[model samples]
Target: MDLSELRVEIDKVDKQIVELFEKRMDIASQVADYKISTGKKVFDKEREDQKLRAVKELASSEFNKTGVEELFSHLMSMSRKLQYQKLASAGAAGNLPFIQIDSIDKASSRVCYQGAEGSYSEAAMKKYFGEEVNSFHVDTFRDAMAVLEDGSADYAVLPIENSTAGIVSEIYDLLTEYEHYIIGEEIIPIRHCLLGVPGTKLSDIKRVYSHPQSLMQSARFLSEHSHFEQISMKNNAFAARKVAQDKDKSQAAIASALAAKVYGLEILEEGINQADSNSTRFIIVTNRKVFLKDAHKVSICMEIPHEAGSLYHMMSHFIYNNLNMTKIESRPIEDKDWEYRFFIDFEGNLADSAVKNALRGLREEAKMLKILGNY
Candidate 1:
């Protein structure tokens, strides 16, 4: 056939495909109605597997067989999403585990934070709760989670991510381990300062101490003074406390200006961190499964089967429901080799129908799913 003739033939086939697609969706809607009436689940893995195999066998070529399977998978995914939306509209979507509160009562609540008095976590807590907020400190992030789990603290502030250094991985694992939920987040700009005892100078410093992340963040400044030995401490405040107690001009700490004031030290240098806009995100967590009424962000974690296209299919739930996913992070499962859990942050309130539909679809398809929080 001539080029124009061949193009005409292809256009005709495309038109037919579009008509067939709409017809198929109409049938899918009928199926959704039937399932809604009969209380039957929308997704049937066995039936889908059988149908895919049957369609693949009818394909004339291997490449066509793979393409057909992919095409059908998407069609089935869309059908499932449609059914979920219908179910949500009918008020069949299950209730989320969290309770909605008007607001967090920060004034009367007792809060806890990781690190010592002058650490960034403490600063975040003060920023979130207020300067006069009643709060205590823990030695580690896990200890902070423990306090929340034990009901000793109404809220716990722990760092989850640093713009310069990346995520605080331990916090992710602890979120999975404990029943606590994040109700809010606070971001604090980091300004690493070189702190030392009175009369201490850059020339007098021989060894420096701070959290490992702080040391890494201040590498640019520390590298210039190669004579100073870098030592890792549990927290920057603890490092400052150590330098203050020792009263040694040779010992210095890379910490916050707050640490210098709290520990009676002097700031030898300021803004030592590599990035001027460096900041850390801290999550305020509570033992109760509650979210603020105006919360706009939802966090969830799920484990999908370690199979090809598993993650893609799970993500399709978000796409089909029009949820704007902001971030996704994966962490290795502790005892499961080659398997990982995904943590997703998306912009949506729990009360929205789209959010309900997406969560319902995910709960059905994912191996395990947990709503971390809405904040």
Candidate 2:
């Protein structure tokens, strides 16, 4: 056949495919209605696997076999989405476990933050809850979680990410380990300074101390002073306090300007970090599973089946529902070799239909699923 004739054949096949697709969707809606009355699940993994294998067997070529499997996988996924929509319209979709509130009662809430005074966590807490906010400090993130668990504090403020150094991994682990939920978040600009005892000069410094991440952030400046030994402390504020207590002119701390004032130390150098726009993101966590009514961001974590295209198929839920995913991170699962848990942050409220649809699909397919929060 000539080129035009071949093109005409392809168009004819495409038209038939579209019409068949529409017919399949109509049947899927009927299936949805049946399941709604019967209370059956939308996703059937064993049935999907069987169908995929059957389709792949019909393909005569190896490459075509793989393509056929992929094509059917998408078709099944689309059908499931349609079924979920039908289920939702029938009021069969289950309600989420989270409660909604107009706003967090900050004035009456007692907050807890990790690290001592003048640390970045404190700054973020003060920024979010006002300077006069009732707050206390703990030595570790776990301790902060413990306080929330025992009802010692109403909210806990903890840093989850840094713009320059990346995420605070412990915070992620703690979130999964504890039953706390993130109610809000605050971003604080980090301005690291080289602080020393009063009247101390740069040349007199023989040792530098700060949190490991703070030391890393100021690596460029610390490298120039190679003669000084770097020591890691629990927090930057602790380092400043130690330097002040020891009255050691030979020791300096890389911390915030607030640390210098709280410890009564002088700032020998300011803006020591490499990045001028360095900042840290802090999350406000509470023991209750409640979120603000106007919250627009949802955080969830899940573990997918250990198989090819599993992750891709899982992500298609977001694409199918048109949800905007903002960030995704993976953490190694404890005691599960070669397996990881995925944490995803997306723009959607828990009350939205699209969010419900996506969550329903994910809950049915994923090995495990947990909604971290909505804020």
1-375, model 1: which lDDT tens digit per residue?
Answer: 999999999999999999998898889989888988999998898899999999999999999999999999888888888888888888889898879899988899999998897888888999999999999998888898888878889999989999989999999999999988999999999999999998887999999999999999998898999999999999999999999999999999999999999989999999999898999999999999998989999999999978878899999888988889999999999999989999999999998889988999999999999999999
RMSD for each model, in Å, please?
1.1, 1.1
TM-scores of all predicted structures: 0.98, 0.98
Candidate 2: tens digits of C-alpha lDDT, residues 201-305 = 999999999999989989999899899899999999999989999998999999999998888999999999999999999999999999898999999999999
Give Cα-based local distance difference scores for all models: 0.92, 0.94
Model 2, TM vs. native:
0.98
Number of the top lDDT candidate: 2
**Per-prediction count of colliding residue pairs?**
0, 0
